[model samples]
Target: MTGRPRLADVAARAGVSMKTVSNVINDFQHVSADTRARVQAAIDEIGYRPNLSARNLALGRAGLIALVVPQLDMPYFAALAGQVLQAAAKRDWVVLIQQTGGDLTVERDALAGRFPQRIDGLILSSTAVGSAELRKRTDRTPLVMLGDRNYQGAAQHVAIDNVAAAAAAVTHLAELGRRRIAMIGSSPGDRRHPRLVGYRLAMKAAGLPIDDRLIKPVRNNLGEEGEQQMTALLAEHAQDPPDAVFCVTDWVALGVVRALRTRGFRVPEDVAVVGFDDIPYGRAATPTLSTISPDRSAIARLAVDSLQAQFEAAAAGTAYEVGEQQAAFRLVVRESSGG
Candidate 1:
C-alpha cells in the first residue's frame, strides 16, 4: 500500500529476506523453485519493479546486447531475431539490431564495435566476415557468432550443423525416388558453403549423378536469385528437367514454386522441392514447403548464454575459452515434398 513498491516490500510480503528477493529477481539458479515462486508472487501482488538501469549501472554494464544480421527482411533472420529478443528479455536485457546487408565493410565495422550506442554483448550472423577479421577485433565486448561461418575458435559460435541438415533434406528427396535432385544456392568459387558440400555429398551417397548444370550458383540467397536461376535451369535442361530441387532457403523455395507454376509444372507431382529454415510463410504457402527446421530458440538461448558467460569471465578476470555450439535441427516434410 505505497506509491512505489520496492524489493523490501516484496521480501516483507513473501516472508523472506531482501537478499532472497534479490536472488529471485536476478534469476539466480541456486535459489529453490518454491522460494522463487513465493518471491515472484509477492512482487506481482505488491506491483514491485526493480530498477534495471541502476542495477546494470552497478554491474558495470549497459544491459544492452546487439544482434547483427545480414538482412532483417529475410524470414529466417527475422525469426531468429525474435527468438533472441525473447531470450534477452528473460534476462531483462535490451537488444539492438544492426543490418549489414552482407557487405564485408559493414560486417567488419560491426566486428570492430561500430554501433549507434554502446552494447554489453554482440551476436552476429555474418557470412562475409572470416576468422582472420574476427581475430582482428579490438573491442572487449563479449561476442557470439550466430551462423554457419567457421570462425576457427576465434569466437564463441551457435548454429545448426548446416552440412548434416542439408544432407538430410536431400536424402529425403532421394528416398522419394527423385534421381535428379538439383540445388539452388551455391556461390561461384566459394566451395566452403556447408550446404553446397552437403548437396554434393548427398548426391554421391544416393548414387545419383551430380549434374553441374543443375547445381546453379547465385549471387545471393534471395527469392529473386532463385527465380532467375530456376529459369536458367529450365532453359538449359528443357529436354530433361530435374525431378526434385533443394533450395538453400524457404524464400528461394517459394520463388522456385512460382517459376514452376508459371511453366505449368506441379510441385511434388512433377518435381519435388525442399527448402531450409521453416519460416511461417513457407508453412502457409500454396504447397507448404518441406524444409530444415533449425532450433532457433536453442541457438538464441545458447548465443546469449555464451555472451553472458564471457561477460562474467571478463568481470572476474578469468580466461574464457571460446566454444562452438551446434543447435539441433530436423527435416519437416510438407506438401511440397509429397508428405
Candidate 2:
C-alpha cells in the first residue's frame, strides 16, 4: 500500500502462497486456471508489477535483446526495428537498437559482444560483416542475422530472398512493356549484392537490352544518391532514357521520381519506377510507389523466435542448431508503375 508492491503483497491479497504468485507471474503451466485468475485479479487490483530484472536474474537472463542495424535512420530499418520491438514486447522482452554506420569494425564489435551491458541476444542487419567474421565470433549471446547478407550456417538468420524479390520487381516492369529498364543502387566492385544479379537476370529473361549506361551505380542506398544517379543517366543518355527503373529501396525510388518530374518525364508514361522495401512513405508519395514488399513483421517474429529458442535451449542445457529462415515477400504494384 505504501512502497513498491512485492510478490508477497499480491499473494496476501489473493489469499495464496508467495510460491503460487511466483508461478502465476512466471506463467508456469502447472497452476490451475481459477487460482491463476485470482492471482491476476489481485495483481491488477494492487497495481503490482513483476520485478522483471529480479525474475530475469533468477532465470539467468537479461530479458533484453539488441538489434544492430547499418543505419537506423533508413526508413526500412526503422520500420523493421518497430516490428522487432513489438514482437519482443509480446514475449515480455525489451529491445535496444544500435547503428553501425556500415562500418565493418562496428559490426564485428557487435558480433563479438562488445556492448556496454550484457544482452540476452542480438539481431543484426549487417552491411559490411562477412561469413568469416561471423564464424570467428566467440560471444555466447544468441545471434540472429536479419537481412540479405549470407552467413547461412554461421548463425540463425531470417530474410527474404533478395534475388527472387528483385527479379519479381524487374519482371513487373518488363510485363508493363518497359524494355529500356534500368537499375539503381548497385555498388561498383561489389558483386555480392543479390539485387544487382536479380536485375540482370530479369533483364536477360525479358529479352530487354541491358545497357551499361542505364545501369547506374551509387555509393549509398539513399534518396539523394538515387536522384544523383538518375540525373547522371539522363544526362549521359539524353537521346535514349530508360522507360522504367528499379531502385533498390523506396527512398531511392522516390528520389528517381523527383528527378523524372524535374526533367518533365511522366511516371509510367515516359518512365515507370519500382522500389524495394514497402516503407510507409511509398504509399503516400505523389504517385504511390510500387515495390518488393518483404514481410518485415514475419522477419522480426522469426528472428526473435529463433533467439528465444536458443535461450531456452541454453537454459535447459541442450544444444540448439542454428539455421536460416526465408521470410515471404511480394511485388506490390502501384501508381508509379501504372497499377
Candidate 3:
C-alpha cells in the first residue's frame, strides 16, 4: 500500500541533505536558491509538507495573539473585537478571542498562570482588573490594554479619555439648552465608566447644578438593563423629564430610544439624546442617535503596533514605559441631539 512520503525520500530526490531539505521546507533563508528550488520540486512531486505543530514546539513559540474582551454580546466590545481581528490578520498572526463578561475574578484568572507563554502576547479590553494586578500577572509578555484606565503598567495602554470625551457630549447638550441632561452608564465602580465625571464637570463648568438624581447606573450595562434604566429615569421625570440624555454606549442609547418612544417623548423635540461608540445601529435607529465616535480602527492599529513592540521588547529583554495612550474620539451630531 502507498504511504505518506518521508522527508528522507524528498531529500534523496532533491539531491540535498535532510537538514537542507528541512530548512527549505521551513522557508529558512539560509538554503541556497538552487537547492531550495530542487527541494521544492521534490516536495511538489511528493506533496510533502512540514508539520507546523512540531516546528512550533521546536522553536518554543506559540505563534498566537489573544484579544480578550469583557463582554462579547456588547456592541462596543464586538466592534473592538472585529478591529483587533483585522489588525492581527494583516500580520499573519492567529488571534484567540475570550470574553470575560466583566467579572473581576474571571478576568484575574484569565491573566494569571502561564498566559504569556500560552500566547505570544495579548490584546485585552478589561473592565475588571486594574493595572496593578495585570502587571503582576503578566511577567514580560506583550500585553496591550484597550480600555479601563488606571492600569499604568509597563505595557502599552490604548484607550480614549472617557472623562474628556464624555464631557464633550454633555457640553454639546448644554450648548443646545439642555439644562437637565441625564446620564446612563455601567457601574460607577468600573474604571472606564464612561462620562460620569465628565458629565459632572461639564455641568459644573456650565454653572448647572449637579444632581445625583439624574445619574442612572445599570447592573451590567446590558442593552436590556439600559432600557430598564431609561424607563426608570423617564418615570422619575414624568412630572418634568430631562431635556436631553447622554448614554454611555450606543447599546444603551438604543435602549434609551426604545424607552423614549414607549414613554411618548418625541426625540429631539421633547427630549434630545446622545450616545457613545457610534455603533452601526445608532445610524438606523428611528431618529438616528447622536454619539461620540471613537476611532476604533485607530485603536486597533495602535494596539497592534504596541503588541508588536511589546513582543520585540520581551524577546530582546528590553523595558518599555507603561503609560496612558489616548485614542481620538469625535462627537457625531445626528437627529437625536438636534443635529
Candidate 4:
C-alpha cells in the first residue's frame, strides 16, 4: 500500500499470466472476456498501475494521443484541447498535449516524435507546418488535422468554412447599417489563414473599399491582447473610427469590447462588434459577444473516432470506414454586435 502495485502481483492475484494483465491494461480485445474481467477485478483489488512506457513497448503502441497546437494560452486552442480530452476519455484513451508555439521544430517533433513507437495518433491545430508535412506523417502514423487551412490530401481534416463564416459575420454587421467595419486577426502569411481572406471578401462584397488601415493583425490570439489590437485598430481609424468591427476570433472580440469600454464606447450602441469561434466565455461575456460557433465538441469527437477506428482496423487487418469529416458553424448573435 505504501508503493505502486506491480503487474506481476496483479497477474498472480488474478490467476493469469502477466501478458494477460498487459493485454487487459492496453484494452486489447484479444483477451477472453472472462480473463479480462478476472484481470480487471484483480487490478482493482490490488490498485495496480502499469508502467506505460514498458507496456507501450510491449504492445507496439504508446496508448496516447498528442494534441499539437500553437499555443494553449489562446482560448480557442485551449478549448480545442479540452474537447479532445473529453472525447478521448469516452473511448478510455489518455491524451498528451504539446504546445508548438508555431515553431516548425516543435511541430515536427510533436508529429515525428511519436514515430516508430509513441502515440497511436495526433490531432494537430498548428501554424508550424503545411499539408505536405501532414501527408508525409500520416503515411507513417495516423494523423488528424484540426485547424490549419491547407489540406494536403492525406490525413482527415476537421474545420469550419472560415471564408463563409467570416463573410457571414461581416454581413450581419453590415445588415445593421454599420458602414465602416474593421477587423482583427492573426498572422497574414499563413497559407491556411482563413480569417484574412474572409475579412477581405466580406468587405468587397459589401461594396466597402479594402482599407488596409482598419485591418489589424496580431502575433497571438489571447483574450488579454484583444484590447491592444482593438486600441491599434481604433488609432488607425481615429479620424473616422469604424462603426463596427469583426474579430477573427472570440478572444479578440472580448478584448475589443474591453477596449471600447475603456474609451467610453458602448458595444452595439457605439460600435457593433462581431467575433469568431463562439467559445464558452463568448456567451458569458458582460454583453454576450456575438460570434461564430463552430461545432468544437463535434470536431473533437470525430477526430478521436477516426483515429480509434483506424487503430482498430489496422490491428485487426480490416478496413475502417473513416472518411473526411467537417464541423458545421452557426452565427450566434448577442448584445455586443447589434444582433
Please, what is the whole-model Cα lDDT of each candidate in the order they appear? 0.90, 0.91, 0.80, 0.80
Give me the overall lDDT of model 4: 0.80
Model 1 lDDT tens row, 1-339: 858998888999999999999888777899999999999999989888899997888788889999999999988999999999999998779999989898888888877888888888999998778888888889999999988777889999889999999999999999999998999988634578889888888988999988777888778778888888888889999999998999999998889988998998999899999999999999999899999999999999999998889999999999999978999999999999998
| Superposed Cα RMSD, model 2 | 1.9
Cα lDDT tens digits for candidate 4, 1-339 = 567899889989999998888888878888999999999999999888777668656756767887888888777877888899999977666898888788888777767764434678888876757767665674445677877376755567778778888889988988888888888775445435677787777778888876677777776776667799888877766779989988888888898999998998888898999988888798898899999999889999989988887787787788654345778899999999765
Across 244-315, the per-residue lDDT of candidate 3 in tens digits comes to 888888888888888888878899998899998998888998899999999999899889878777766766
Q: Pick out the ten consecutive residues of candidate 4 with the lowest summed lDDT.
A: 186-195
Alpha-carbon error at 40 in model 4, in Å? 14
TM-score of every candidate relative to the true structure: 0.93, 0.93, 0.80, 0.76
Q: Which candidate's TM-score is highest?
A: 2
lDDT of 3: 0.80
Q: Candidate 1 — which residues are off by over 4 angstroms? A: 11-24, 27-42
Clashes of 4: 0
Query: How would the candidate models be sorted by lDDT, starting from the highest?
Result: 2, 1, 4, 3
Clashes in each model (backbone N, CA, C under 3 Å)?
Answer: 0, 0, 1, 0
Per-residue lDDT of candidate 2, residues 1-339 (tens digit)? 899998999999999999999999989999999999999999999999988888898779888999999998899999999999999998888998999999988888988889888899999988877787788888989999888778859888889999999999999999999889989988534577889888888989998877766777878878899999999989988998899999989999999999999999999799999999999999999899999999999999999999999999998999999887999999999999998
- Model 3 ranges off by over 4 Å: 1-60, 113-117, 186-194
**Residue pairs that clash (backbone atoms under 3 angstroms), model 3:** 131-151
Sliding window of 10 residues with minimal summed lDDT for model 1: 185-194
